[model samples]
Target: MEIVFTVLILLLAVAASGVAARLAPFKLPLPLFQIGLGAVLALPLFGLRISFDPELFLLLFIPPLLFSDGWRIPKREFFRLSKPILALALGLVLFTVVGVGYFIHWMIPVISLPAAFALAAVLSPTDAVAVSSIVGKGRLPTTLQHVLEGEALMNDASGLVAFKFAIGAVLSGTFSLMDASLSFVLIAIGGIVVGLAVAWSFGLVRRKIIEWAGDEPGVQVVLLLLIPFAAYIFAEHFGLSGILSAVAAGMLMPYVETAGAESAATRMQGRSILMMLEFVFNGMSFLLLGLQLPGIVGLAHIDAQMAGNVPVWHLFAYIAAITAALIAMRFFWVWFNLRLKSFSSALRGRRSKQRALDVRLISITSLSGVRGAITLAAVMSIPLAMPNGSAFPARDLLIFLATGVILCSLLSGSFFLPWLLKGLQLDGEHQRQRAEEMRARARVSEAAVRGIENAHDKLSTQLDEADQALLTEVSGSLLATYRMRMDAESDSEETHRVANRFKQFERELRLEALRAERQELHRLRAQQEINDETFMSLINQIDMAETWLLGSLSSSN
Candidate 1:
């Protein structure tokens, strides 16, 4: 208990550094850096170690991360990519177990294939938290991002389901086709039913509590925090998937409805509550990734040494092979499913751009298979001894391999992803430029609306009262949109539509003026008319305006 609390303190320090760095110029990837930091602390001299109980993690950490991710994912996008997400989450996991398990068992005659299946099951889930939290800042296609998000969400439940069956097989020293299939079906159905029931129950309780508290912010936030865990415990107590129950409750939790006409203050308050929860969980997860190193070494050293010359080098190699199969299998499945989506979209003339976009995105997601706390937890929860007083084979090897995969993936994905962003011509500079252009064009709309208002005001004596009221509402909304544009704050979906209409017209009018200003500035620079700083600053102004204009036009719909 002392050690757990101490390790948490260190994790807090690491998270603080990460959160601070996010606001600083010294940008670094979260997974690679934090995990590396923890690994550095794991050396003999540092003597930092952490012991995580399986149920403790499931109870404490899983709820917020699952809820936050589920809540933030745009509902429209989640639904749109549901097909591919479901495939990766469910179909791909089963495929991996069958494929990877068969190969591992065949390669090592002594080990039962069901044992290999257990290894396979552990590696089947993708850690979107690691991947997204690390490098999600980079330029990527929306279609690809949503797909990756969806895959991570559903894959947890699928992998956990398979894991249970494998564990059951090991316990009984027998595997049953009918029972495994039925168990999975029951887990899924039972989880969803339990999750919804709990969501409703907790929501009712929260509503009553809020009325009692009379809108106390602290009470509201506390109630929100309790719902995910409440829902999870309710499901798992009934023998359903606790993780899925968390995800389901989160998905059902108030997004827009709870914050009707969501005020900025209220949204920020809610987001901060979630962000804090995510921060603590994420920090602990990365630390857990590294802290298990010594325990794993102790766990696997004997088996690894004995199996070094064998077809498998121990449990590590077993897990390594399964991880490879799980990752490799994704490429084929993603490409195949995407092509099918493409064909349907092509028939309707709707799918071409996004299909091309997703190809590159899936490649990135393939590298983002960084096993984090969930995978570590699953492996850690592997039964310590079999029913007949025999130890589980390769338990140590499983931990070692899981750690290796996590490291290699964190490094490779974080470094290579930025390069992919460049190759794909998706970068922050483009996003910033585009944002500026949209705001510039929005300014033009505001100017036009102002002119209309002035004319209407001057002619008010000639107009009807209803006409004046309609004009006043429309004009005020337009001006409100303009104000938001100036600050680069997000506007309502309706304001976005109006802003987009004026973009092209503004571009045509201002393009020439901007060009002429550039020519004069160039001439001045050519004649040593301005210093490099001033000339560049002047040039940047025009470029920023143009980008905002273009972005405003494209994103309007």
Candidate 2:
């Protein structure tokens, strides 16, 4: 009964979130709101309850969310933005790890350096879900949006690789710069190789099956679904980047081959499945985070009363500290890079340079650091025990801290982001916003046109409305011309259909012309021309006969 009830509530929560998404002034993403609501509901004391564990977290959350996100981001975009992606993913993550690790050790001598580094690694990668939730909706310029998204995606790979190295260093009680460099290079290369192999193999199977059989149901989709986890696990077994493997596999899959149409039919069928998995897993992970609060707070209370001054919920402190560290680091990096960029786009002063660099965009995105479900899931899976029998460096503490940051960042960012936008005076010139939406619509129209342009003449949508109707007419005319052009070269079914249509319309016009000539002959007879217009009548009859012959010829053929 409890399980059923919880599921019902979560379903309600998702439904409510969908409504809130449209109604809210600020574009608070549905996933972010679901998490915020879960936290709020948990405060009621008697409102809701659930149990959570590391296994549940690992088994349920990461793969699907990561896979879905990876699939949606195109491979070309990923490769195109590789430079900025590397800067944000590898360079920025390393900078955060070293800077935060040193700070934590300095702030609390009681914590070991390894423990501090562990803390740094855990907090290194910014959550893509969070960034998308907080900053990505109907905001930012296109280039920056791409940069941030690419950063979020690739950083998971870089951060996870760094994390494994940090963990290994902790276990072995030694760290080496050379080893870290070699490990990152190898893991990245190896993961790409493994992931590409996995993606290519699946692509091959998909091609054969699609060629032999045709369209598949959701089961084949499921096989595609597991690619991420399979790639991740296999890569990790060989000491490579599991996160990268998952990301790479997803990123590569669509471009390779598929059994489904890039049409409305497939999208309509697959949309529900994709959305359901994402929604259910997202809610479960956040709910688990909320569930842990009770257990963690209880333990911290006891720890506080022990010979300590105030038991400083050090977890919350760490969450805030690291969250701050991330926020500060991003802004600093953005500012510095903008200056560097200004040199190339030089002849602008420093303020002009900064303004030219986009002051508000840098600030808003920096503050929009909303940790979310993925971060919670990863933190929840931290091992409770180390290899040597000591506790995992602040394991419970890290979980608590990560959860706090996720909640804090999301709630505060979502609720306040509107005000920040307004305050920055980045509010004017919504031309870009309108233009983007128009471009999106144009893309659909263009795709439809392309379908008509092809020999297959296959399209996914039912066309209507003024814009679409106009597009359909234009495409029909263009296709007719194209087929006419092709007729001189070869005879194809597509060209024949178009040619038939053209002939049919032409014959109708000829019949109309002949009817007009017959009426003219009657008018001539009434006016007394050449003895009752007999000669003109005969001419009109001949023209009418020719029209019928041509019209009939078109119909029969």
Candidate 3:
């Protein structure tokens, strides 16, 4: 019953979040709003107490999210930006663990060094889910978005590995720089090796399944869903990074090949499922974080009696200091990288304009380091007691401080991002992309017309007069429509206006045609001439046609 209730609450939160994002008068990032709603619902009078075992949450939520992200991320872009991504994901993460770790220890004398390092590791990785929600589509430069997302994907593994080592240090009451450094390299490399091996095997099986069940989209989506969990479990079983395993599995899948060949229904259904998964996982994670606030605050004071001479406000002050240090270090690192980028680009004889763009992107990337679910999960997973049974040093305070950083990062990132975007005027880049798209579509249409002409010639001898007339009319209409879109750029203003008028007339005709086709499908189903599955398939094609026509009309304007 508790499980059911928890699920119900999460579903409700997800629904509310969707509705709010669509209906709200003012712009509020969905994650931030969900967090606020959850915080409000956590009031004592609301009687909505929520608790999550950090380990369970981490295992359940992180895998699919990471896998989905990896699957969708463009492989070309990811590789091209690999250098900057490594800088942020691995280099910056390690730097933060040391820089912020020492800062936290300085601020809170009671917190041991290992514990401080643990906190730093927990807070180092930025949550891509949170960042994505905060920066919706078309808000950031594409390059910047890709870099941030790439950073988000890789940093989780690095941060968590550092976290494990820090925890090991705390539990064993010893630390060796040489051993830790060697161990870090081994674990990082080993995890990647395990991830790649497991994911490659899974991909082979998945490809076979896709071949066998190619027509069954529902079955295919279910199989795809399982890959992430399977990859995570296998990697973790081998004492490797489950997060990297899931990411690797997603990346290895036949993203490019299958995408072109999949049926429209399959593609749409798969996308819908992944989108819903993201919405639920991200929304619930933030909501749960908000609900945990009161409990977390209470836990922060759990050792109040033992915490002599330390006040709650003082702890908050320490949290503030640590959060500042984290943000400050990111700025410094980003600035340093930008300088290096500028120097390298100069040596290569790149333009000053490119250097300026780099500065803008790195600035946004630096600000986008908002720690989220993974951080919260890692901190909350800290053991309540050491091996000797003494209370884990400053566990509660660490949670509190981590929460402080999460809030600060989210608020600051979401608030200023839009303003920064406005200043950059990145819409020209979007326009350039649209223009390129038009060129590509025109080329495709030209090839399609050539194919039509060939088919007409080949079929003329086989078809009767009526069939020939139908083919001529249909193919002529297609050729005309494509030619108009193809000429949209080079045409004069008056010519474009005439073309748009034709486009509008064509749109109405196409929509009417689609309506007739749908009615025919429904009629066929009702008459028992076609099964429900066949009717649905026909209707889906019609729906897609209608959608494309409508979308094309909108894009033209």
Which stretches of candidate 2 lie above 4 Å from their native place? 1-13, 16-32, 40-51, 259-264, 302-308, 311-318, 343-355, 423-557
How well does candidate 1 match the true structure in TM-score terms? 0.72
TM-scores for every candidate against the unseen true structure: 0.72, 0.70, 0.88
lDDT ranking, high to low: 3, 1, 2
How high is the lDDT of residue 525 in model 3?
83
For each candidate in the order shown, give its overall lDDT on alpha carbons.
0.71, 0.66, 0.79
lDDT score at residue 420, model 2, on the 0-100 scale: 63
- Full-model lDDT, candidate 1: 0.71
Residue ranges of candidate 3 with Cα displaced over 4 Å: 21-26, 193-203, 210-214, 254-261, 299-308, 344-353, 356-363, 427-432, 464-466, 489-501, 508-542, 550-557
Instruction: For candidate 2, write residues 459-538 as lDDT tens digits.
Output: 31454466566766777787655444344223367865766566567667777776787777767777777465575557
lDDT of 1 by residue, 336-403 (tens): 77788778888997746652645666777677666667777787788888888898776665556656
RMSD of candidates 1 onward, in order? 11.0, 16.1, 3.5
Q: Going through the candidates in order, what is the number of backbone clashes in each?
A: 7, 0, 0
Cα lDDT of candidate 3 equals 0.79
